[model samples]
Target: MNQTLHAIAPEKGRKNKSTQDDVVYAHIFDAILEQRLAPGTKLNEESLGEIFGVSRTIIRRALSRLGHEQVVVLRPNRGAVVASPTIEEARQIVFARRIVEKAVTELVIDNAEDSQIDKLNQLVLEEQECFSRGDRGAGIRLSGEFHLQMAEMADNPPLLSFQRSLVSQCSLIIAQFESGAKSHCSYDEHFELIDAIKKRDKSKAVRLMMHHLDHVEKKLSLDDDNASDDLKAVFSNVRGKK
Candidate 1:
């Protein structure tokens, strides 16, 4: 769980007015984030409908929404598949990530409060626990969340919402583009980023985050590797024992 934005899914027992299509949308979207569905993977309507216990209509609706979000692609005669973003698109994703998160990091420090810093510390502790237990899922989820929680630190509701979307989309890109699910902060760089924030060292935090994103971009194997499925098998071996 290197990035954790999707972990805070809609409450388990609370319907909250969302439709079944929306539920499938979230589930599949999270699956992409978790790299359970590699980019460019075929998504058959009947198979998805069966898996999700929904009709083709509902699956279509969900796929349509994901298409709008740039997470899934629908082509003429090709139907639907997980979006295999190009290197150009990957660069744009990194650019968008830097702009959105840098702004939030600045805001986090400017509007710093004792409680938010305290919460960040608590989050980091839980992050460490996940690390010790070798729970990559938690690390992945928490990595993304480190930025979203920073948005909360800023106390800007609208910007927070937008940042949340940006991070969600970023997760999809990382899932596809990066050769491995292992994130840039495996050494707890996020802890240092937030520590700088808590100390009100705005400049340092911004620089750290920028460097982190750049490192992440560099880790991407965006060369002649067009076969996502085989590459995903390589990534899935990150911690698996033979």
Candidate 2:
């Protein structure tokens, strides 16, 4: 009786802590995905704790989650920072994405309902609007979301999970290595993908997916260099959202 209550009490406390950690994790992940927190940006634990209004323990847990997902690199003595994938790593990431996203395309075409397709169209519209308004960060995030949502529509939990991490990594990769002013994805290409899915043209959808990935990969050059440790200014928008 007393023993059982004590065990359950500890579990409940852990659950509450985990829930708080998830909120913090999502904010950081979305910030990275949106390119607001640029690659190589230092993520100061104390600053994050103050911004999120949580303890350092909670902030650490959230950063740990991001580290595990490979978007944030955890340093032993230096703490954590946004991961800047090396050029070689960037190549492999795109290669892996091509494989996974092709499968995701096929599955989505087979499983996605018309309503789901419509929802994807709506996402593209929003992405176009964002780009038109010069909100490139928001636009790029929405472009990544379009793919993530397609993975979700594929009806495979494992694939969706893989995409959740891969999309974030790719976004980071683009922010680090992309050349010139090219965008990560074209909204027009996204629309064509939806049309192929709507018509259940698996071959066309897969082809479009591959070509789209190739464009994104080809835009990467080694000329970019970025470094910033202004943690609060980097996360200013994220802090305002809290």
In candidate 2, what are the lDDT values of residues 34-122, reduced to their tens digit? 45676778888898999888889999998997887788999999999888788889889999999899999999988999999999898
- Report the lDDT tens digits of candidate 1 across residue range 57-130: 99898888777767788887878888877777778888887987888888888897888888777777776776
Instruction: List, in order, the clash count of every candidate structure.
Output: 16, 0
RMSD of each: 5.9, 8.1
Candidate with top lDDT is 2
Worst 10 residues of 1 by lDDT: 233-242
Badly placed stretches (over 4 Å) of model 1 are: 1-19, 74-78, 180-187, 222-242
Model 1: per-residue Cα lDDT at residue 29: 71
Report lDDT (CA) for all predictions: 0.69, 0.77
Q: Quote each prediction's TM-score.
A: 0.75, 0.82
